[model samples]
Target: MGVGDVSKRILLGRKLRSAQLGETLLPKRIALPVFASDALSSVAYAPDEVFIMLSLAGASYYVWSWKIAIAVAIVMAAVIASYRQTVHAYPSGGGDYEVAQVNLGKTAGTTVASALLVDYILTVAVSISSAAQYAASAVGWLQGHEALFASAMVLLLTASNLRGIRESGSFFAWPTYAFMFAILGMCLFGFFQLVAGTLPDVESADLVISPAPEYEGAVTTLGLLFLLARAFSSGCAALTGVEAISNGVPAFKRPKSRNAATTLLLLGMIAITMMVSIIVLAKKMGLRYVDPREFDRMTYFDGAPLPEDYDQHAVIAQIARAVFLDFSPGFYFVVTVTGIILVLAANTAFNGFPVLGSILAKDGYAPRALGSRGDRLAYSNGILFLAGMAIVLIIAFDAEVTKLIQLYIVGVFISFNLSQLGMIKHWTRELTTERDPDRRGKIYRSRVINAVGLSFTSVVLVVVLITKFLAGAWITILAMLFFFAVMRAIKGHYDKVQLELAADEDDKVLPTRVHAVVLVSKIHKPTLRALAFAKASRPNVLEGIYVATDPVETNRLIDAWDERNLGVPLKVLHSPYRELVRPILQYVAEIRKSNPRGVVAVYIPEYVVGRWWEQLLHNQTALRLKGRLLFSPGVMVTSVPYQLRSSEIAREREEREDFRVRPGDLRRGQVDERRDPGRRG
Candidate 1:
C-alpha cells in the first residue's frame, strides 16, 4: 500500500466485503431519517419561502399562507399514496426513472432520470447552503464564508457516505430525530400558547411590508392569482425529498417495500404537519418577512424605514424566539437542531443519487464505474461525483440559499408528474393482465390513487414552471436537458461497443505467427530483460530494435553488439528528427501492414519506481511507444518491468501495510485482496 491507500483506509475505515452488503441495509428506524431528512428539513425554509413569495404583494397576502400550506400538504399526500403503489409495484429501487421507462417509454424514462439527477444535485446545494446560513447566523465568525463552509460540508458528507450506507445512516439518524422532536415540540408549544390566547408576537411582527414595485398600485385579479400560485409553488419545496424513499427501497431490510412505504408515510405526515404548523403559527403570530435583499420593503408602523443593519431572522428563528422567550435553551436547541437537520437533509440526496446512478450505469445509461461497489460496498464513484458537482454549485452561488432555492423543486416536480403518470399506466396494464379479481380491484384503486397524484403533481409542475422559469428555474431545465443528452450519448456509445465486442467465430482464430521485437535504448539491465523475455517467447522471428539519431552512438552500439556476439540481430531505425515514438510506430506499422495475418509482439521494458515522483524521471519513451503500438493493427504490446533499487522502499511499505505488489502480478493470475478481512481491491 502507498501513502494514499493508508490515508484512504484511515478516512473511510476498514473495508467491507461484498458479502457484507446486507449488513449495510437499513431497518425502518434508521431508514426514515436517512431518506426523509430532506423533506423534513424543508420545514425550516419552505414556509419562509412561501412567506417571501407572498410578501411581494404586501402582508395583506399573508392570509393565504396557511391556505398554500394546506394545498402543498394535499399534493404531498397524493404523492405519498402514489409512491406506496410504486414501492409495491416496482421495488427494485429505480424509483421514478424505472417506473417511467417500464411503463411509458425510453424517452420518458430518460427525461425523468435527467430531472431527478439535476434535482438531487440541487438538493445537496440548497440544503448545505441553508445550513451554512444558519451556521453563520449563529456563529458571527462564520459570516461571509458560507461558500467555503458549505463546500467543506459537502466534502465531509462525501467522505461519510463513502464509508457505506449503514455507517452514514447510523451517524445521521440521531440528528434527524432530534430535529423532528425539537421542531414538533416548538410547534406544539406555539399552538398551546395560541389556544390559551397568550401567543406572543414575533420579533418582526411590528414591522409592515411595502408592496413590491409592480404591485404597489391596484392589483388585477390575474396578478393576485399569479402571486398566490408563486407562493404555493415555493412552498412545494417541502416535497423535494419524498421520492428518495421510493428510489431507496432496495436499501431497506426485509420486507423492503413495506418498510420503505411505511417510511414514506412517516415522512409525508411529519413534513406536512411541520410545514403546515409553521405557516399557521407564523400567521397567528404575525411574522413579517421580506426579501433580505430588499430591505426597503420592510418599515415600522409609522412609515419609517427600518435600520440598514436590522437583522431579519428566518421564519423558524422568529417562531422559536417568540415561543421560547423565557427559556433561552429551548430557542437555542431548536435553532441548533434546525441547522443540523438542514445539513443532514443533503444526506437524502447523497443516498438517492448514488443508487440511481448505479442503476443507470447497469442499464448502460451511465459509466460502468458507477455500478461497481467500492471496498466498503458503497458507490464511491457516484458519491465523489455528486460531491464535486454540488461543491461547484455552492461555490458558484456563494452558498446563498435564497439564490440556490430558485433552482430547486422544478426537477423534483417534473419527476413527480412523470412518475405518477407512469404509475397510472403501470396499474392499468396490471388490470388488463391480472386475472384475480381481488388483485384487479387493488390495481383499480391504485390506478385511481395514481391518477389523483398525477393530477395534483401536474398542476404543481405547471405552476412551478410558470412562476419560476424566469426566476432561475430555466437553469434547472437546461441542466436536465444536458444530462438527458449525455446519458443518451453514453448509452449509445455503450451499445456500439457492446455490439463490436461481442465474440464471433472469427475472433477465436489464433494468429498465423508471432514476430517478437524488443525495444532497446541501451545495453542496460531493463533492455537485457526485455531481450530475454522476447527470446523466451520463441517467436517465428526476433530482433532488437533501436532508434538511432547519431552516427557515433549507432557505431558504438553496433561495435558493442558485435563484440558481445549476441545471437539476436540488431535493427536500427534511423530518425533524422530524433523522434522516438513516431519512428518506432512507423516501423511497427510497416511490419503489421505487411503481415496482417501475423501478430507483432512489442516488448517494452519499463522501470518500476517506489516513489510516485520518481516515475516522472523514467519510462517516458517506453510509455509513449506502448501507447501507440497497442492501438495498431496486428500488434500486441507487453510491459516488461525492471524493478529499481529504490523499489524496495515500495515493497517494504506495502509489506508493513499488509499489501503486496508482485511483479507481473496479472500474468501470474494474482488476485488483489486481503486474506484475513476479505476486502476487494
Candidate 2:
C-alpha cells in the first residue's frame, strides 16, 4: 500500500464493505442520548439565560423566573407532541424539508432547510461553549482560555462522530444518562430539603443587584411587561433541540417512528422537569445572578463594591452548591456531569444535521458529495463542515455562553413553527385523498395536535423575534437568509447543469467524422501506449503532434520515430517562447477551425504511480494539456494510463484482499462490488 492509503487507514480505520449496514442501526437506549442530548442539556444554561435577562431589571424581576419556565415548558410540550405526529407521517427522515416540499412547495422546503442548518450549527457552538464555561467554573486554570477549550472540545466531538452515529451514540449515551440522573437527583434532593425546612440560601444570597441605568427606580407597567416578555423569550432556549428527534426518525432502528416519538416525549419531560426545578430552586435559595457585563451595578451586603474579579456561578451551579453543601463529592459530581452533558449536547446536532444534509444533497439542493458516505459510513464532509463552523463561532464569540445563547433559539423556533405549519397542511391534504372514515378521523386528530403545536410555537417565535432581535438574534436571521440564498443558488446550478448535460435525440446523432491527434513528447512506453489506444479507436484522420522546445531533442524524437517505421504521420510545431501548453492548444484550435462539424479526440498518456511522490515526478504536461482541451468546444480528452512497476505491486495487493465493513457502515448500506469484466484490462 502507498503512504496515502496507509495514512487514511490510520485515521479512519479499516475500510468497510457495504453489506454490513444493518449493524449500525440505533436502538432506543442509545438513540435517546444521541438525539435528545441537546434538548436535555439545555437545562444546564437555559435557566441561566432567563436569570440573566431578568437581571436587567434588578432582583425583583427574578420572582417571575419560574413563571417564564412554565410558559417555555408548555410550548415545548406542544412542539414535542407535534413532532411525534411528524415522525409517524414522514419516516423517511427528511424531517421539515421533506414535509414542506411534499405538502408546501419547494421554496418552503428549502427555507426550512436553511433555518434548520443554521440552527444546527448554532446548537453545536452554543452547547460546547456553555460546557466550556461550566468547565472554567470548575477549574480555575481554565478561566480565560474558554474559547480554546471549547474549540478543542468541538474537535474531539467531531472526530468521535466521524466514526458514525451509532458508534458515537453508544459512546456518548452513558454521560448523557449520567447528566439526566445528576440533575434529576439534585432537583429531588433540593425539593425534599425545602419540604424539611433545611435548605440553605446560596452564597450570593446576600448580594444586592442594582438595575441597569435605564431601569433605575420603579419601572412602568408596560416596561415591566416587555421586560418579562424578553426574559421569557430567552428562557425558550430550552426548546431549541426539541425538533431534532423528528428530523432524525430514520436513524432509529425498526419501528423508527415509535422509538423517535418515545424519545421526544422523554426529552420533553426531562427538560421541563429539570428547567422548572432549577428555576424554583434558584428562587428558593435566593441565588443572585447577573450579566457579568453589568457587574458594576452589583454590591455586597456591607455596602461595598463586589470584588473586581468576582465570578458569578450559573443558576444550576448555585443550586447544586446550595443543595450539596457539606458533601463535596456530590457538588463536584453534579458540576462535572452538567458540564460534560452540555458538551455532548452538540452530539445531537452532529447526528441530525448530516442526515438532513444528505437528504438535501440527494435531492440536488446540496453538494453531491454530502450524499455519498465516507469510509466509515458517516457523512464525514457534513460532520467536518459543522464542526469547523462551530469552532469559528466559538472563537469569534470567545466561548461566552451568554453571547452565543443570544444567537441560539430564534432559528430553531423558526424551523419549529414552519414545520408545524407544514405538518398541519400535510395532514389536511392526506385527509382529502382518504375515503375511510376511521382513517380520516385519525388524520383529523393529528391535524389538531399539529395545529396546537403551530399556535404555541408561532407565539414563541414572534416573542423571540420581537424581544431578542436586537440582542444578537438578528445575526442568526441574517445567517439563515444567507444559507437560504446559497442553497437556492446550488439548486439552480444543479438544474442548469442537468438541462445542459441531459442526453436527447439530438445527442444520438454522431459527428460526420473523427480526427484523432496523439500528444507526443518522447519516444517511450507512454507515447507508444497512447498511439496504440488512439489507433484502435480507428478515427478517419490521425497524426502524432509534438511541441518543439528544443530542436536537437525534437530531431532525435523524429529520427527514432522514422527508424521504427511507425505508420502514423508526425506533425511538429515550433515555439520560440518555450510555451509547451499554448503551442499544443493552438494546433488543436486550428484543427477545429478547419472541420467545425468533426470531433477532435486528443489521446494523452498518463502514468499510474503507486507512491505519492512518484505522481509528482510525472504527468505535468499531460495534466495541463487535458485541462486546456476540455475548455475547447467539440473536443474530447482521453487518458490512456500506462502502469509503472510499483503500480503493479500495489494493484496485486489490493486484488488479494477483500474489504470488511467498519463501525457505522451497517446503517448506511453502502456496497462495493468487484471490478467489472470490461475494466479488467
Candidate 3:
C-alpha cells in the first residue's frame, strides 16, 4: 500500500492471527533461559567484584569472600521465597508493582516501579558491558573497542527480541543451558582435582596484590567489617535479577504461577550453586585478582609486570583455564558459553521491563501504546526503549563492567525490600479475612516467609547503599529518581488531557448556529469536491476562505468562482507576510468572536496520495492548520480527502497483501489479516 505500510510489512514479516498467540506460549525448556539468564549470568562478574573489594586488604581478605557469598546467598534465598509467594498470590503479572499498590499504596507502588525500571535498564547495560569484557578477553581486536562491541551486542539482542519473545527464547535457550553446564562442569571437575590432590593453581596464584592507598596498614577490626560489608554488597549483584521471574509470571504456560514458582526455585538453586562453586574454585586455585586500576600489583617471575597488553581473564576464565588446561575443548566451551550467557542475560530485563511497562501503561502511568502487543506478540516499544537506554549507558561507561556493575543491584534490592514488605502486608490482610483454618494457617506461614524475606532484603538494601553508593551506586539512585519523575509527569499529562477533553454537561447543548468555511488552495476538482461536501452540511452560514498569498492566484480563483456561479461568497484574508496558518487561524478566531454561540467548521481539502513523499509535498499547510484548529474552542476541523490516481495503486497493492503487523500488536500477538478493516469489496 503506502510506503509506511510496505516498510512495516517488510520489517515485521508475515503476521500471524491473534488466535495463534497461544502457540507463542513458552514451555519450561525455553522459559528457564528466557527468564533466568540475568541472574545466572551474574556469576561471570559477581566473583570478580567480590575479589576486587577484598583486594582492599590484599589476598588475606579472600577468606572473607566465601562468607560474603553466604550472606548474599541467604538474601537471594529470602528474595526468591518471597517472590514465589508473590507469583502464587498475584499471578495477574503485576509483580511487585501490583502487590505494593494493592497492599501498600499508590506511592509505594510507584516507588517500586521506579526502582524496578531503573534496575531493568541497568541489567541490560551491565550484562552487555560484561559480555563485551569477556569478548575483549577472548579476542584481542575487541579490547580497545569494547564499547562498540557492546553496542553491537545490544543491537543484535534487540533484533532477536523484536522477533517476539517465543522465538528469541528458543534462540537464547541453548546458551543459557550451556552456561549452566560449563560453569557446573568446570566446578565439578575442579573439585575432583582438588579431592585427588592434583588441582593446579591458577596462573595468577603466585602474584601479589597491593592494597589501595586508603586501606594501607594493619587491618583493624572495624576496617575488616567494612571491607567485608563492601564485598558482601558487591556479591549481592548475583541477586539483581531474582525478581524478574515474579515480574514475568504471565509469560509462562498454563498454571503460570506454579511454573513461575518452579522456575524461581530452579534459578535460585542454579545461581547459588554456580556462584558458590566459582567462589570455592577461585579460593582453592589461589586466584589472585584485583581492580583493573591496581592490576599492576600482579606480576610474573623476576618481579616484572605481566605483558602490558596481557588479557587479564575473569575469575571464571582463570579457573576454567586451570581446571581445563589439558582439556582445550572444555576451556573453550566454558569461555564461549560464559560470553553468550552474559549477552543473553539482558533478555531477562527485556522480558520483564515490557511486561512491567504494559502494567504501568494499563494503569495510566505510561504511554498507552506500550499497553498493547506487537505482531510477534512482543512489547516492541518497551524492548526498543530498554535497548536504547542500555546503549547510551554502555557508550557513556565505555563498556566497562566494573563501573557499570557499581550501578547494578541497588535498584533491584530496593524493589526486593519493598516487594517483601508489601507481601507481608498482603498476608496480614488475608489472615484477617480468612475464616477457614487450613487456609489461614497457610497464609500465616506465608506471612512468616515474607517477614523473613523483608528482613533479609532490608539488610541487603542498606548494605548495598552504604557500601556501593560512593563507589557509583548514587548514579543508580539518581536514575531511579529520574524514572519516578518521568512516569509521574507522563501520568499527570495524560490525566490533565483526559480532564480537559472529557465531555461535560454543556457538551449536549446544541450550538446557536453553524458557520462553515471551505479552504481552497486552487479552484480544482479537490476544491470543488470540498465545496460540495461543505454545502451538504447546510450550515447557517457558508463561505469559501482563501489566504491571498499571491495576487495572481487570488484573481484566478475569484474569476473561477464567478464563472462557476457557486453562490457561496468568497472571503479573502490578506497576509502580506505570507503566513498561511496564522492568518487563517486569526480569521477563524474573529469569526468565532463575532458570534460567540456559533460553531465554526473549517473544511480542509487534503490530497491523499499513495507515496509518503507525495504527502510531504501536499497538505503541509492543511495539516498544520488542522492541528492548530483542534486546540481552538468552538472550532471543528474536518479533512476532505481527495484521493489521486496514485492512491488507487497503493490501495490495490494493500488489498493484495495478505496481512500486516503493527507496533504493539506483537506483544498481544494480534495480526491484521486484512489490508484495511474498513475497506469494502
Candidate 4:
C-alpha cells in the first residue's frame, strides 16, 4: 500500500464494506455514553456558571442555587418525556429537524436545523475548553497553553470518530461511566457526611465575595429578580446535549426507538440527580465562586486581597478535594475522570453533527459530498468539518469556558422549543384520523406531555434571549442565520442544476458524424499510439494537429511525418506569441463551427507516472489543451494514457495487500467466511 494509505489504515483502523453497517449499531449500554456524555459532562461547568451569575449579587444569593437547579431539572424531565414521543414517531433519526419540517413547515424545519447545527459546534468548543481549564488546574505546567491542549484533544476525537461510531463509542464508554460514578459517589458520600454531622466546608468557603459595583446595593430591591433570571438561564445549560439521543435513533440496535427513549430517560434522571446534588452540596458547604476574570472581587476573610496568581478550581474539583480530604486517590480519580469525560463530551456532538449533516445533504440542503460515506461507512467529511469549526472557536476564545458558555444555550433552547412544538403538531395531526379508543388515548397523553415540554422550553428560550443576547448569545443567533441562508442557497443551486440536467428526447439520439483530431508532439510512440486509437474508432474524418512554438521543430516534425509514409495529413498552427493552449483552442473551435451537427473528438496523449513528483515532469501541454477544449460545444476531449516505467510501483502497491482481514468482521457476519482473503489456501 502507499504510505498515505498505510497511515490512514493505522489511524482509522480499516475500511468496511457498506453492507457491514449493521455490525456498527450500538446496544443501549454503549449508546448511553455515546449520546449522553455531553449532558452529563455539563455538570462540570453548568453549576459553576450559575454560581458565577449569582455571585454578581454576592454570597447572599447563593441560596437560590438549588432552586434554579430544580427548575432546570423540571425542564429537562419534560424534554425527555417529549423526546420519547419523538423517537417513537420518527425513527429515521432526523430528530428535531425532521419533526419540525414534517409537522410545522419547511421554514421551521430549516430554522431548527440551523439552530441544532450551531449548538452542536458550540458543544464541542465549550466542552473541550472546560476540559482544558481542568487540565491546567490539575497540572500547573499546562496553565497558559489551554488552547493548544484543547485543540489537540479535538484532533484526537476527530481521528477516533473517523473510525466510525461503534469503535469510537466503545473507546469513550468507560470514561463516561466513570464520570457518572465519580460524581454520584461523591454526592452520596457528601450527603452521608451531612447526616453524620461531619460535613466540612470547601476550600473557598471562607473567602468574602464582593458583589459587582452595579448590583452592590440591589440585593433587597427588584433587581434581584433579574439577577436570578440570569442565573437560571445559565443553569439550564444541562439541557444542551439531551436532543442528541433523539437524533441518534438510527444508530441503535433493533427496536431503535425504544432503546433511544430508554437512553434518554436514563440520561435525564442521572443528569438531574447529579446536577441538583452538586448545587445543594456546594451551597451546604458554603462554596463561593466568582468569574476568574473578576478575581479581584474575591478576598480573604480578614478583608485582605487574594494573591494575583491564586488558581481557582472548578466546582467539581473543589467538591472532590473536600469530600475526599484524607483519601488523595479518590480526589485524584474524580479529577482525572472529570477532565477525561469533559473531553469525550464533544464525542456526542461528533456523532450527532455528522449524521445530521448526511441527512441534510441527502435532502439537497447541503453539498452532496457530505452524503457519501467513506470506505469505513462513516461520514468522514462531516467529522472533519465539525472538528475544524470547533478548533477555530477554541482558538478565537482562547479556550476560556466562561466566555464560550455565554454563546452555548441559545441554539439548544431554540431547537428544543421548536422540536417540542413540532411534536405537539404531529400528535394533533395523528389524533384527527385515529378512531380506536386505545390509540386515541395514547396520542392524547403524548400530546399533553409535548404541550408541557413546549411550555417549559418556550419560557426558557425567552429567558435565554433576554438575559444572554448582549453577552454572547447574539453571536449564535447570527451564526444560525448564516447557516440557514447558506443551506437555502445550496438547495436552490441543486434544484436549478437538477432541472437543467433533466434529459430530453434529443439527448438520446446519436450525432450525425465524428471528426477526430489527434495532437502530436512529435513522430514518436505516444503520437503513433494516439493515431492508432483514433483510427480504430472509425471516424468519418481524421487528421493530426500540432501547435508550433518554434519553426525549426515544426519543420522537423513535417519531414519526419512524410518519411514515415503516413496517409493522414499533419497540420501545424503557428503561435507567434508562443502560446500552446490558445492555438489548439482556435483549431478545435474551427472544426466545431464547420460541422455544427457533428462531434469533434480531440485525443491528447498523457503520461501516467507512479511517483507524485514524476507527474509534474510530463503532460503540462496536454492538460492545458484539455481544459480549454472542454467548454467548447459538441467537442469531446479524451486523454490517452501512456504508462511510464515507474507506474509499476503503483501497480505493485495495489496488489501487495489487495485483501485485508478486519478482526471480528467474519464472526459478526459482516464478511463471508469462505471468501475471507486472509485465510490460508
Candidate 5:
C-alpha cells in the first residue's frame, strides 16, 4: 500500500464493505448519545443563556428563569412527540426534509433543508465554543486560547466521526452518560443540602447584579414581556438537537421506528430533567450567569461595578462548586464531564448533518460527493465540510458562546414549525386512504399532537426572529437563503445536464469518419504501445503527432521513426516558446475545424506509478494537454496506462490487505478464509 493509504487507514481505521452497513446500526444505549448528545448537553449552557437574558432586565427577572425553562421543556416535549409520529410514518431518515417534501411540496422541503443545514452548522459551532469556555474555566492556560482550542476540538471530532458513526458513538457514549449522571447527582445532592438547611451559596452570590441601562430605569409591563420572550427564545437552545433523532431513524437497529421513538422519549426526559434541575439548583444556590462584558455595569455588595476582567463561571460550574463544596473530586468530575459532553454534543450535528446532506444529494439539491460513503461507511466528506464551517465560525466569533447562541435556535425552530406542519398534512393525507377505524383514530390523535407542536413552534419561531434578528439571527437567515439559492442553482445545473445528455435516436448515429492521432514525445515503449493501441482501433486515418520544441530531438525522432518503420506517418508541430499544452491544444482545435462532422481521437500514453509522488513527477504535461483538449469540439482524449514494476508492490500489498480482517467484520459475519493460490487440491 502507498504511504497515503496506510496513513489514512491508521487514522480512520479499516474500510467496511457495503454489506457491513447493518453492523453500524446503533442500539438504544449508544444511539441515545450519538443522536441526542447535543440536546442533552445543552443543559450546561441553556440555563446560562436564560440567566444571561434575564440579567439584562436586572436580577429581579431571575424568577422567570424557571418559567422559561418550563416553557422550553414543554416545547421540547411537543416537538419530541411530534417527531415520534414522524419516525413511524417516514422512517426513511429524511426527517424534516422528507416530511415537508412529501406533504408541503418542493419549496417547503427546500426551505426546511436549508434551515436544517444552517442549524447543524450552528450546533457544532455553539457546542464546541461552549466546551472551550468550560475548558478555559478549568485549565488556566486555555483561557486566552479559546478559538484555538475550539478549532482543535472541531478537528478532533471530525477525525473521530470519519471513523464511522457506531465507533464515534461508542467513543462518546461514556462521556455523555457520565455527564448525565454527574449533573443529576449534583442536583440530587444540592437538593438534599437544601432540605437539610445546609446549602451553600454560589461563588458569585456575594455580588449584586445591576440591570442594563434600559432596564435600570422603570420597567414597564410590555418591557417585562419582551424580556421574558427573549429569555424563552434563548432557553430554547435546548431543543436544537431534538429533531436529530427523527433524522437518524434509519441508523437504528431492528424495528427502527420504535427504537428511534424510544430514544427520543429518553432524550427528551433526560434533557428536560437536567435542564429543569440546573435551573432549580441555580435558583437555590443563588447562582448568577451573565455576559461578563455586562460585569462592567454590574455592582458588588460594596456598591461598586465589577472590573472588566473579572472571571465569570458558567451556571452549571457555579452550581457544581456550590453543591460539591466539601468534595473537590466531585466538583472536578462534574466540571470535567460537562466540558467533555459539551464537545461531544457537537457529535449530534456530526451524525445528523451528513445523513441529511446525503439525502439532499440524492435529491440533487447538494453536490453528489456528499452522497458517497467513505472507507468506514461514514459520510466523511460531509463531516469534513461541517467541521470546516464550524471552525470558520469558531474563529470568526472568537469562540464566544453568547455570540454564537444568538444564531443557534432560529434555524432549528424554523425547521420545527415547518416539519410539524408537514406532519399535520401527512396525517391528513393518510386519513384519506385509511379504512380501519383504529388506524383512523390514531391518525387523528397524531394530527392533534402535530397541530399543537406546530402552534408552539410557530410562536417560538416568531419570538426568535423578533428577539434575535438584530443580535445575529439575520446572518443565519441570510445564510439559509444563500444555501437555498445555491441548492436551487445546483439542481438546475444537474437537470440541465441530464436533459442535454439524455439518450435518443439522434445519439445512435455513427460519425462519418474517424481521424486518430497518437501523442508522442519519444519513440519508447510507452509511445509504441500508444501507437499500436491507436492502430488497433482501425480508424479511417492514423498519424503519429509530436510537438517539437528542440531541433536536435525533432531530427533524432524523425530518424528513429524511419528506422523503426512505424506504419503510421509522422507529423511534427514546431513550437518556439517551448510550450507543450497550448500548441497541442491549438493543433487539436485545427484538426477539429477541418472536419466538423468527423471524430478526432487523441491517444496519450500515461505512466501508472505505485506511489502518489511518483505520479506528480510524471503526468504534468499529459494532464495539461488532456485538460485543454477536452474543451475542443469533435475530439476525444484517451489515456493508455503503462504500469511500472513498482505497481506490482502495490498490487500484492492490496491482495494481502484485502484478505485481512477489517473493522465491523465480526458484526457483518465476515469469516476470514485463506486460500493458497500456489496449492492445488
Candidate 6:
C-alpha cells in the first residue's frame, strides 16, 4: 500500500462494503449520544446563560429563573411531540426540509434547509467553544488558546465521524451516558440534601449581584417583560439540538421511525430535566454569574465592585462544587465529564450536518460532491466541510462561548417554527384524505400538536430576534440568507447546465470526417510516440502541430522532421506573444470552423511522474492545452501518457494496494488473491 492508503487506514479505519451499511445503523443506546449530545450538553451552559441574563437585572430577578426554565421545558415538549409526528410521516431523513418542501413548496423547503445548515454550523461552533471554555477553567494554561484548541477538536471529531455513524456512536455513547449519570446523580443527591435542609451554599453565595445601570431603578412593566423575554431567549439554547433526531430518523435501527421517536422523547425529557435542575440548583445555591464584559454590574457583599479578573465558574461547575464540597473526587469527576460531554456535543452536528447536506445535494440545491459517501459509508466531504466552517467561526469569535452563544438559537428556532408549521399543514391535508375514523383522529391530534408547537416556537423566535438581533443574532440571519441565495444560485446553474447538456435526436449522428492533430513541443521521444500513435489511428487528415515559441527551435524541428522522413506533415503555428495553449486552442477552433461537420482530435503528450513535486515540473503546458481545447465544439482532447522511471514505483505500489485485505474479509473466509488481471508482459 502507498503512504496515503496507510495513513487513511490509520485515520478512518478500513472501508466498509455497501452491503455492510446495515451494520452502521445505530440503536437507541448509541443513537442518543450520537444525536442528542448537543441538547444534553446544553445543561452545562444554557443555565449559565439564564443566570447571566438574569444577573443583568440583579439577584432580585433570580426568582424568574425557574419560571424561564419551565417555559423552555414546555416549549421543548411541544416541539418534541410535534416532531414525533414528523418522524412517522416523513421518515426518509429529510426531516423539516423535506416536509416543508413537499407541503409548503420549494421556497419554504429551501428556507428550512438554509436555516438548518446555519444552525448545524452554529451547533458545532457553540459546542466546541463551550468545551474550550471548560477546558480553560480546568487547566489554567489553556485560557488564551481556546480558539486553536477548539479548531483542533473540530478536526478530531471530523475524523472520528468519518469512520461511520454506528462506530462513532458507540465510541461516544459511554461519555454521553457518563455525563447523564453524573449530572442526574448530582441533581438527585443535591435535592435529597435540600429536602433534609442540609444543602450547602455555593462559593459565590456571598457575592452580591447588582442590576446594570438601566435596571437599577424602578423599571416599567414593558421593561420588565423585555428583561424576562431576553432571559428566556438565552435559556432557549437548550432546544438547539432537538430537531437533530427528526433529521436523522433513517439512521436508527429496525422500525426506524419508532426508534427515532422514542429517542426524541428520551432526549427531550433528559434535556429538560438537566436544564431545569441546573437552573433550580443555581438559584438555590445563590450562584452569581454575569457576562464578564459587564463587570461593573457585579459586586462584593460590602458594596465594592467585582474585580475585572474575577473568573466566574460556570453554573453547573459551581453547583457541582457546592453539592460535593466534602468529596474532592466528586467535584473533579463532574467537571471532567461536563467538559468531555461539551466536546462530544459537537459530534451531534457532525452527524446531522452531513446527512442534511447530502439530502440537499440530492435535491440539486447543493454541490453534487456532497451526495457521494466515503468508503466508510459516511458523508466524508460534508463532514470535512462542516469542520472547516466551524473552525472559521471559532477563530472569528476567538472561541468565546458567551459571544458564540448569542448567535446560537436563532436559526434553530427559525427551523423549528417553519418545520412545525409545515407539519401542521401536512397533517391537515392528510386528515382530509384519511377516512378511517381512528387514523383521522390520530392525524387531527398530530395537527393540533404541530399547531401548538408552531405557536410557541413563533413566539420564541420573535423574542430571540428582538433580544439578540443587535447582539450578534443578525450575523446568523445574514448567514442563513447568504446560504439560501448561494443554494438557489447553485440550483439555477445546475439547471442551466442540464438544459444545455440535454440530448437531441441528432446527438448520435456521426461526424463527416476525423482530423487528428498531435501536439509537439520538440523533436523528442514523447513527440515521436504521439506522432506514431496518431498515424496508427489513420484519420482522414493527420498532422503534427507545433507552436513556434522560438524561430530557431521551430526551424531545427522542421529540419529534424524532414531528416526522419516522417510521412505526416508538420504544421507550426507562429506566436508573437510566446503563448503555447491559446494558439493551439485557436488553431483547433479554426479547424472546426473550416469543416464544421468534421471532428478534430487533439492528442497531447504528458509525462507521468511518481512523486507529487515531480508533477509540477512537467505537464504544465499539456494540461492547459487540453483544458482549453476540450471546450471547443467538434473537438476531442486526449492525453497520451509517457511514464517515467519513478512512475514504475507508483505502479507497483498501486498494484500491491489493489490486493490488500479489507475489513470483514477474514470473517467472511475469503481467500487473499494477489493475481493481477492486467499483468504486464
The Cα local distance difference test for each model comes to 0.91, 0.87, 0.88, 0.92, 0.90, 0.90
Name the better of 2 and 4 by lDDT: 4
- Least lDDT summed over 10 consecutive residues: which range in candidate 5? 672-681
Please say which candidate is ahead in TM-score: 2 or 3. Answer: 2
- Kindly give the stretch of ten consecutive residues in candidate 4 with the minimal lDDT sum: 672-681
lDDT of 4 by residue, 31-112 (tens): 9999999999999999999999999989989988999999999999999999999999999999999999998898998999
Question: TM-scores across all candidates?
Answer: 0.94, 0.96, 0.95, 0.96, 0.97, 0.95
TM-score of 3: 0.95
Candidate 5 structure quality by residue, lDDT tens digits, 1-681: 667888998999887778789989999999999999999999988898899989987777788888888999999999989999999999999999999999998899999999999999999999999999888977899998999999999999999999999999999999999998999999999889989999999998887777888887889999999999999999999899999999999899989999999999999899999999889888877776678667765668899877767789888888888888889999999999999998999999999999999999999999999999999999988999999999999999999988988888898898898899999988998899999999999999999999999999999999999999999999999999999999999999999999999999988889889999998899899999999899899999999888899999999999999999988999899999988887778877787788888899999999888877788889889988888887888899889989898777788888887667666656654533434434422
- Per-prediction tally of clashes: 0, 6, 16, 0, 0, 0
User: Candidate 6: where is the Cα deviation over 4 Å?
Assistant: 506-509, 522-529, 532-538, 549-560, 563-566, 574-578, 662-664, 672-681
How would you encode candidate 2's per-residue C-alpha lDDT over 1-681 as one tens digit per residue?
A: 567777877766665546556667899999899988999988888888888888888988898988898898898889888999999999998888888888779888888999999999999999999889888878999999999999999999988888778789988999999988999999999999999999999988999998898788899998898888888888888888887888788778989999998988888888899999989999999988888788887898777998888888887778888899989788888899899998999999998899889999999889988888887888888998899999999999999887887788888887787788899888888887999999999999999999999899888888889888898999999999998999999999999999999998998888988999998888899999899999999999999999899989999999999999779999999999999899888888998999998999999888998777888999998888888788899999999999999898878877654344446545544223333334422
The TM-score of candidate 5 is: 0.97
Q: Write the per-residue lDDT of candidate 1 for residues 178-236, one digit (tens) a residue.
A: 99999999999999999999999999999999899999988899999999999999999
- Tens-digit lDDT string for candidate 3 (461-508): 888889888989999999888888888899899999999999999889
Q: Which stretches of candidate 2 lie over 4 Å from their true place?
A: 656-681
- The lowest-lDDT stretch of 10 consecutive residues in candidate 3 is 672-681
Q: What is candidate 6's lDDT per residue for 394-463, written digit by digit as tens? A: 9999999889988999988888888888888888888778789999888888899999999999999999
- Candidate order by lDDT, decreasing, is 4, 1, 5, 6, 3, 2
Clashes of 2: 6
